[model samples]
Target: MDDFLERTRQALAAQPFTQLLGATLERMDGEGVALALPLRDELKQQNGFAHGGVLSYLADNALTIAGAMGLGRAVLTSEFKINYLRPAVGATLVARATVIHAGRRQAVCRCDVFARDGHGEKIVATAQGTIAKVDELPAG
Candidate 1:
């Protein structure tokens, strides 16, 4: 399991967009996956809050990771919806997701995005999605 998780993490790092966002795998297991990104000025909007696109990206990727890890197979997010609970103002952002259900071809997942700051972590957004299985993931 550790080896599989490590390989998945490496594959994630190899993704150009994920690398551009500086996303990291904080945790991945039977329970779920947690992906984190450090908050940077370049990632913020004009109001100095985390961009909506950034949060959406985290939710989508985290949902896919959770579903893939649960089924021990590769998966892609078919669709997802997210709601911003509040403005994200923090040092880092973490998106944690869990597979609620899984079948032969698809998995349903839920994700919560949080912002970590000097005080602590706060929920910034929530997401739900369906992930469809694939033949295999491309090697890194």
Candidate 2:
């Protein structure tokens, strides 16, 4: 498990776009994975809210990580579905992902995103994804 976490961290750090968004893995275990992204002007939409794409991207990455953690192998997203719940207006966003099911070739995971406003945390978006396990990829 320590080796898996180390490899995941190194892989995440090497992603240029993820680094640009300042996304970090806060927690990872058999149950789930958590990721955080600070709200920045560059990530906002015209309405001054966190952009849908940003939320989707974070959710996708979170789910992928969770699936990989469960399988102990590198994986890629094959399909994803996202639902917007509310406007994301906050200092940062947090995404929690859990594996729903795992098969030999594919895994299903769900991710929920929350925005921390002054009042409290609110649901911003929800996502489900299908990840394909790849055997040939080099481990980090």
Candidate 3:
């Protein structure tokens, strides 16, 4: 688990946009990965709700990590579709993703986004993605 955490941290460091969004990897395992981001003024839209792009970013990374766990290599999102179920109003947003199926080159994954809702958490978005295993990430 420690080794996986270290590797995940290094992979995330290569993603400056993820860092700028203030996202943190909370967990990573064979079954899934969990990520969290704080709801800040900078992340909000003019209506004071968390921006849709932020939600999409959270889902994309979570699903990619889940697919990578199954493939044992870095993975790139081939395609993804997200459904925004509600406005994200909360102190923090969390995304959990799991791999549904995997083959030699690609994997199917799903992610659910939740936001603090005073009582517990509320579902704000859901996503499904296809990710392809890659030997290495592209140069920036």
Candidate 4:
């Protein structure tokens, strides 16, 4: 289990876009996974708030990671929907993803994105995703 988790983490970290977005895997367990992204100029919209796309991408990635843990294999997102609750104008954002349902070939997960400031945290977005389990292709 430890080996699998380590390999997954390494693979996730190697994603260039994830690195570009400053996304970091904070926690991972049998139930779920958590990810964090710090607010930076590149992530901001013209109005100086975190872009909606950034939140969606973070939530998608978080849920995908969690679903992969549940399936014990690689998975691809079959569908995703996101709701924007409020503008994200904090120093950082945290996405907590939990696997709501798991089956032999499909899994469903939800992610809540929170904007964290010195004062407190606020729900900035929420997302639900369906992922399809896929076998890892043999390496040449």
Cα RMSD to the true fold for all candidates: 1.6, 1.9, 1.3, 2.0
Cα deviation of 117, candidate 2, in Å: 3.1
lDDT of each: 0.92, 0.90, 0.91, 0.87
- Summarize candidate 1's per-residue lDDT along 28-131 as a digit string, tens digits: 87778999999999999999999999999999999988888766657778899999999999999999999999988889999999999999999999999999
Residue 75's lDDT in candidate 2: 87
> In model 1, what lDDT does residue 73 have?
58
In candidate 2, stretches whose alpha carbon ends up further than 4 angstroms from where it belongs are: 138-140
The runs of at least 3 residues in candidate 3 whose Cα sits more than 4 Å from the true structure, single-residue gaps closed, are none
Q: Estimate TM-scores for all models.
A: 0.94, 0.93, 0.94, 0.92
lDDT of 3: 0.91
Pairs in steric clash, model 4: none
Residue-level lDDT tens digits of model 3 in 8-105: 88888878898898899888876689999999999999999999999999999999989888887677999999999999999999999999999999
Which ten-residue region of model 3 has the weakest summed lDDT?
1-10
Evaluate model 3: give its TM-score. Answer: 0.94
Span of 10 residues, lowest total lDDT, candidate 4: 131-140
Would you list the rank order by TM-score, best first?
1, 3, 2, 4
Off by over 4 Å in 4: 137-140
Candidate 2, residue 68: lDDT: 91
Q: What tens-digit string does per-residue lDDT give for candidate 4 at 1-140?
A: 68877887797787899888888888887767888899998899999999999999999898888788777676888899999999999999999999999899988999999999999999999999998898873452
